[model samples]
Target chain A: MNKFGIVMLYSILLFSNQIFGQFNALEKGVFSGSFESISQWYQDDNKIIVSVPQDKWATNNYLSLHYTFGKFYAGLQYEAYMPPLLGYSRKFDGSGVAHKFFSYRGDFMEITVGDFYEQFGSGLIFRAYENRQLGIDNALNGVNIRLKPSDFFSLKLVYGKQRKYFEESNGILRGLDGDLDIIKLFKIQKNIGLQIGASLLSHYELYTGADPLFPPTVNSYSGRLDFNSTRLTLSSEYVFKESDPLDLNYFWYKTGNALLLNAAYASNGLAMNLSLRRLENMDSRSERTATDTELMINFLPANTKQHKYSLANIYPYSAQVMGEIGGQYSVFYKIPTGSLLGGKYGTKLNFNYSVYYGLDTTFLGGTQGFESKYFAYGEELYYQDINFELDKKWSKAFKTVLGYMNQRYNKAQVDGGDYPIVNSDIVFFDFLVKFPKNRSIRTEIQHLSTKDDLKSWVAALIELNINPSWTIYAADMYNYGNAGEKVHYYNVGTSFVKNVHRIEISYSRQRESLMCVGGVCRQVPAFKGLTLNISSSF
Target chain B: MKKVRIILLVVSVLIALGNQSEAQTVLPNVMVESITGQEVSAMNFFNDGKPMIISFWATWCKPCILELDAISDEYDEWREETGVILLAVSIDDERSLASVKTLSAGRDWPFTIYLDKNQDLKRALNVVNVPHTFLLNGKGEIVWQHNSYVPGAEQELYEEILKLTENK
Candidate 1:
């Protein structure tokens, strides 16, 4: 329940493990857990446009403990925030037992109580999860039970109130899902595996608005089918929601719909995947009045390349809940080691392309916001990326990765339009050299030449490891395209690691930008500060 | 009342474990999805009672990929001596699920892999970072675990597997 209690419990666990080893002959269970604590000190710097709100110091900590014995398992998570970080929400400025659950999984059935997270079919219709960096925890706080009567049939039932901030949402949510293995169900000895599933989710809350057509409850249903073989896999899901007036949709009583499809083919040295999604008024939330990353009950993943490079991710994308159509296609190929293009080691070439367009819709004003035609695209382009990369190992001691990208980001459409559309060309290089005695050095260099927005920029990072124990990292990003003085953002840090404990301290100047994780974006203002991070596990 | 229930659950579990002490370190029976989008249980992945080396990783973590590559270089030699299998667990969220599938194919990883999209297994195993590896004996009990990566960490892992078979 508290830090002291947790430490005491762990001590008791360690003490009991010793006693049990001597007395209990048949059973020897294990207790394992980890904790991470971050502390930061902020200092104001008008030169870099960093403004620190009244508070200058912030710290956050989380400790989770899990115990497993035979078929029974229990876990507890404790979190403390002595005033959360700047970008993190203030609502988390407290200490408490964030999650606690007990579950028993048997051959025929599994049951859980307290807090739990789950998802169904690409999470297009329902997803309950926790993203600590984003300050979101929608874990169900009730009961969940799954029944596997046979190898072919599986069913699940869940009821709970969604977690919001430090508390639970007012509305109550309930869902039931059933999955059937068609091939196994019929005992059909076929090559391809077939599975189908259906889910019905509902949310209930008291009506507080005077609108006569406003419904106090919302219902959504989803169905999915999946087929897979040794080299091919296909999965599709469709969802529909009843008419409900909520803030996200201007309190208009409009129905919602969504469709997602993914198909892939893979061989020994080649693989390709394609994804398609269409969402129209499909923003589902627990509370009718919730808006903008609040009380979300479903997850609509943005079908775009999640770039690994810093500059490539500058213009990230989030799926529009109102109306959007998009898809992504990616291919990965490995040239054999002895081929003409492949030198001594095999060469890896990756190509990725993605595009999203706004829905072609006309507004009717008043309660009727707009109307759109299916399978029609507007002239507006939300985001696009054409990227290719090649990875090669020149020798046993050297390896390198080269990449190029062309991107078009519609600021008005993707980032709520504070600036003009930005088109950029990027080049990336990564080299790693390994020396004897487990020593290694890695360097990453990226250059983005943009004609708009922040203009052209260049970044370089180097990481040197003195083998098994110590590492030093440094990086700097400079914006040269900006007229007049060049703006530079730099950071240097060192980390020491031994066994399960790791500690890192760094001082850096951050650039103001929108950082995104899984299509969800958060604004991180420019700041000059010292950060300390520590992690330990047992 | 909530805190009390939590304490009660923990105490009850401790008592149960104390009373039902059993041999054979067992992997927790958690459900995870494979690359083909099929739901599978971790319990059935014991490799017919062979040694198992499980690694948790993410696409964005560069060190993790490096470590896996090093292990892949000698995977065949290790398999010859001990009937061991490698199980790679990708904790990539929905954003990078495509890459996980695509990379698995192009690289032709010679191991069984699963996706822990929501980190259920990662949390169950208390892995704090990517590149964390676990070595399990023939009995499926997790005998050794190490976090992070060094160039020759796999050698240490192999030694543990050798110790397991020797004890047998």
Candidate 2:
């Protein structure tokens, strides 16, 4: 569908809601519509793996419309692929064709049927979602309901089959979840509140594999509790499941569980939070018969910081779901204004640290020394990071901030076994300065070292802002450590803004790797190229 | 083992140190870039502008982009009619910026656009969803805010913008 058609469709959806008596004609009409197109260039040594030509570029277009009436909002999205689209061929379960419809009604109570997305609890068991630009969608064609009778209570139920790309899985997926505030229900005292939740999911699918085994039905359950007081809070969740066999194999069926905990404390100008999680054999596939990265039934959203700066996120850590244990803690504070340490508008400070390790196998006793559900076999120190920052306002137009970060990366876990184990240490420093004339300058520098690979690297970035409408940025990441491939990765970019629209363009030499989010990752390839960006509202 | 323990200890210290702020606090370092590509620190964006209005948005966020587009159509007359400057920023990644240019140029939006590719501005603003808008006074202090967008939501934004810029 074209942009205009999408807008008209949205207009009609809003017109349907106009019966609510909350919008006028102009207010009820199509408010905004947009169409976006993406052209991706890719190349790799593995033709069988990539599936697309190395020398060609592929593209896709998306058009969407949004409409509203009172508290009701609805949206329609159309994504089209004109064959030879990069990644689309291998990614889609069907030929170059895909389309979806989504809508939501009411704030506290919503029902999404057809091809829709949903997340339950922490999404450990079921989460159907889409990142269209990434060509990732695990949307389910199911009946889902959400009900919140009170501020602290929520209940959700879902039953349907997952849409794997353009095709729907044969398995039937069903789930139930409920969340309630113990304190609110009992009308507890001040400075204290408690919340509890539970969830259950079941999947049924018939299977006839090469091994000639019937697909076993799968069952999963989870529970969580949270307690909050005047200055402290504690939250924890535990999940358990009965594992189905791989290809109806009698040897593969195994039970598993996962545990997560979080605690925090806060006071004037200072705050701290801590989290710990241990997962084992927790993979939940919707089809119940599928394996690996296909037919995933759930998503685990990360609670850590999703950095914006390039170097700081160069080795971003994706959450691991297979089996592992990790924890993260963070602190933030501010010096009082006018104090010795708080020169000018008080100095601000922040620090954070996180670490992940392979699980202890001895505790996980399984048959025939076949690892227990709790055991982790990978190398330790999958990924670790430490960061610090300080900010201050010196004068009316002269604010500044300085920050530094140190990170340790394990390529084995981050790269999904594609690359060898790499123990890397990276350090970064950044500065931001505001000019008196409403202009500003932001600069960053970084260095990375590794002994496993003969590569150490350095990077620098500077962005000049001309206030309210324009900015120019330049950056370079150099591989000073590579023995023979010493190359400088450079990027120069600029952006122009007017009202609700912004355009940003850049050129860069790149390296490719999988962009992982905890345990999930997508392969992002490297290339030498120029890129442009344009975005606006209305 | 010792190193792991030390690292854990440091993390504990950091969390302990972080406990001094208000219970529900915003990340101070998070800032959104304005249409002019200027980084508008989340904290400074409000509390300093002339009763500011901040909206959290994304290129893929249709309702949010639409709400702003509708407001921009009358933004000039609203500015001449009222002096409020509506700032709109895109949460689109660097790769999608080109489309924003062609898309916006075709529509000729009346507002300014900033890019928050990394969502720093979003985290600092304590926004979990797009189409979220915050209203602040000239001192940059936030006063009013709303989440999601309805068809006529711009009418409400205009009313608030007019009130903030009124007689300033």
Candidate 3:
């Protein structure tokens, strides 16, 4: 199948060129693509206890090409994972042409055949997407059509099977989404905007199990409304799913539901946002038996703030797919340049608070999963965080950022571990100073203190940036307060970037950690290795 | 047989490259949502026969914020000198999307912002990382692009814009 795909792709390219060559006007086609390679060579480390893979080296490569001519477009992506990286799923052990599609995008309508990624309003009910870092690519292999008949309404239809690694899942999925611009349709107030959207999705698979009451089909629906203006924005979505007896839910036939609400107001130098979400048995997959980010048909992102600092990300939040309730509120403000706190360049301040808890439920054995009251809080706290940051520019060349965070993470609930809830406080200071000839240096010093689980840690990093192309950095993280062995995870790296090409080389001791992108996460195993990354687009 | 297949693939790619015409580097016609919740075509983002900068960034990316902040400090001078317009495209999905408006407004950045909620434009542009920026000429052709951002990188970007305007 892989060979056929490759052959067919090449054939299309060749055939298209020949067919378009007959017309001089159609010869003006655009070809664009990108290539990326991440390779690692591992070495044994005496300070850490980690089981290295037998290969001792691994590389992941991706090459994608896209061609656009007039209103028609086609693209394909080929991926190769030579002895897949440690902690990556074993399913992606080989190489293949993973994605391919052709589509005609007109002003009023679009139609696509083959593979495509799509999402409904906020992706509450259905979303077919990919996150390469998380080893997730659930692009549907089938047909997709989008129609915009008027200025006020648009509709999308999709029917396909979800992609699982290099193969397609057995289940067939069908989805329909429609959106209406209420303000535009009704010619209402010009100062305000309102929109409404709804989605319906269903999955069907053959039943092969022995359970007589098992369902081979599941259906889900979602509705959303959005309001927008120059200063205020509000949106809400609600999803409901029919009974789905899947492995993730312990074969429970109970229905699923979710709700998400967001509101934001922004004005000169001041902005505030609040988001609330509740998820109950909302996990849906094309393959009933699939688990661990595989074959997911919907996306439910964690509402917590995404941290950039290394230490602050140690206990990142992963959304509880089964049942959880959470909300986050954030505020951003800037002091005027002439104010007392603002010096000459003004100061920026940010504050955020987020919390999550498990759902209160009464469990019933067998096909009946559990029952829970609406808007009730559970006794078990999943996660909580409160953080504040201040950024100040003292001079033209000198700037600093100070931040503090307090967090409580329930290890047993988020990650399947038999451990008590861990509470920690983190403080960090970052400084950047510029020099002549476009040379600059940035430094960060951070400390994390806790009484439980890993005790405490201290980390520091310094980076130098050279104009036009070069960046070098070194960092060290020490587990100083650990009761057991004290270890230092150190890293040094340099990168040279020019135009669309970037090459980076690094040597480091990688601590076992969960790397996440946009709320999706994957565990990376500990190893000492020299890493090389090369990427370019043309 | 494997070697033959490899050779065929290489030959086909070379042929495709050879057949490339002098096509203008225009933005993909993908639909993205404006900050005001209106759907707009990315291809229509032009500066009325002036230079434009389209930057792909996320709220969580520290370097992206730093670069934008640095640009904001000099944006007035840049616009006055080169008549260049900046378009900040937020690739934040539903997770950290709400903060985009707040961050931009709070920072008082003088740039038009759009939301690529599903990352259609990001994928089309083949941007693997944030802080990737493209500089387009008056003809809407992508003339210069850079990946990643370091402190003072905006100076180099300004130089590129100067070169574009000088040519004009």
The TM-score that candidate 3 achieves is 0.96
Taking the tens digit of each residue's C-alpha lDDT, what string does model 2 give over A259-324?
878776655566677777777666667665464356777665433444445666667776665567
Worst 10 residues of 2 chain B by lDDT: B20-29
Question: What is the alpha-carbon interface RMSD for each candidate?
Answer: 5.8, 23.1, 3.1
Span of ten consecutive residues with least summed lDDT in model 3 chain A: A16-25
Deviation (Å) of A480 in candidate 3: 0.7
How many clashes show up in model 2? 52
Ranking of candidates on DockQ, top first = 3, 1, 2
Chain A TM-score of each candidate structure, as shown: 0.95, 0.83, 0.96
Model 1, range A222-241, lDDT digits (tens) per residue?
Answer: 99999989888888899999
Predicted structure 1: lDDT: 0.81
Please, what is the TM-score per model?
0.92, 0.70, 0.96
Q: What are the C-alpha RMSDs, in order, of all predicted structures? A: 4.1, 14.2, 2.4
Candidate 3 per-residue lDDT, tens place, A5-70, comes to 877867765664565455435556677777787888988887888767788888777777877788
Residue A307 in candidate 3, Cα distance off native in Å: 0.2
DockQ: which is higher, 1 or 3?
3
